[model samples]
Target: MIYKVFYQPKPEQVPVRENTESFYVEASSEREARKILADKNISIEFVQQISGVFLEYEKQNLNFKVEQG
Candidate 1:
């Protein structure tokens, strides 16, 4: 199956929009599809398998924070 991944890398840049990209990857299964892109440091927003429904995964939380005591 071919999965189209829409993602924006971490530490996203600037006020301009266009932060995400659509990439097509061929894989055997949904899990495999995710693994393929994971290697590239791409933060997935949505991934829809070509000719099929979107694949779901655990949402990632990567917020930066600072604490003072």
Candidate 2:
């Protein structure tokens, strides 16, 4: 299954944990994902696995039609 890992860097780093990030990874199970993070030694203040996610539309598709009252 695909797991979306959201994480924040260690507090001591220049970029604090406030600015978080997420990435998709394929793993057999949640435990496996955790192991991967451990092996990589990523100091994360927070972590979560997202079930699903939606991406923004393309630049050209950003425009939308609406009738103003």
Q: CA lDDT of 45 in candidate 2? A: 45
- At residue 66, candidate 2 shows an lDDT of 18
**Reference-based TM-score of each model:** 0.57, 0.50
lDDT score for residue 11 of model 1: 34
Q: Which ten residues in a row have the lowest lDDT in candidate 1?
A: 60-69
State residue 34's C-alpha deviation in candidate 1, in Å: 0.7
Flag regions of model 2 displaced more than 4 Å: 11-17, 45-69
**lDDT (Cα, tens digit) per residue for candidate 1, span 30-65:** 687777666676567877765532322211213212
Candidate 2 has which clashing residue pairs, if any? none
Pairs that clash in candidate 1: none
Report each candidate's C-alpha RMSD, comma-separated, in the order given: 14.5, 11.9
Clashes per model (N, Cα, C within 3 A)? 0, 0
